[model samples]
Each structure stands twice: as C-alpha cells, then as structure tokens.
Target: MSPSKQGKSQLIDSLYQKAKKLHWKQCEQCRVKKNLFKFVR
Candidate 1:
C-alpha cells in the first residue's frame, strides 16, 4: 500500500525473474554438454 513497499515488491519480482532466467540458461548448458558427451562417446 505504501510507496516503499511497492518499490520493494517490484525489486523482488525483478530479481526472481532474473534468477529464473539464469536457472533455465544453466539447464540448457547442461543439456548441451550432456549431448556433446554422448556424441563423443
């Protein structure tokens, strides 16, 4: 309800989105590595 609270909520939401993106990126990298290893073997 207050301006400060609203700002904090927005900051937290932004951080959460960033974290989700990073997690997905890491997952993708792992998948790629796994495929590469499979191909090499």
Candidate 2:
C-alpha cells in the first residue's frame, strides 16, 4: 500500500480502538459529531 494510505488506515484503526474504550453513553454524541465532521470534510 502507499505510505499515505497506510497512514490513514492506521489512524482509522486507532480511532476505532479509542472509541471502543469509551463508555457507550459517554461516547455516543461525540462519536456522532466526529463522524459528521469527518464526512463533511
């Protein structure tokens, strides 16, 4: 894979892991907002 692609995959994986560590209720709103921003950008 290209270096840029690899970096992006790694970043996504790290974000998924961090999200998994959060309490569901605590993370719900933040996760939605983050995903919205990600999609918008």
Best by lDDT: 1
lDDT of 1 by residue, 1-41 (tens): 99999999999999999999999999999999999999999
Off by over 4 Å in 2: 24-41
Q: How close is candidate 1 to the true structure, as a TM-score?
A: 0.85
Taken over the whole model, the C-alpha lDDT of each candidate is 1.00, 0.90
Error of 1 at 12 (Å): 0.4
Residue 1 CA displacement from its true place in model 2, Å: 0.5
> Residue 12 lDDT in model 2?
100
Please give the range of 10 consecutive residues that has the lowest summed lDDT in model 1: 1-10
Q: List the residue pairs that clash in candidate 1.
A: none
TM-score of each model, paired residue for residue = 0.85, 0.54
Q: Of the candidates shown, which would achieve the greatest TM-score relative to the real structure?
A: 1
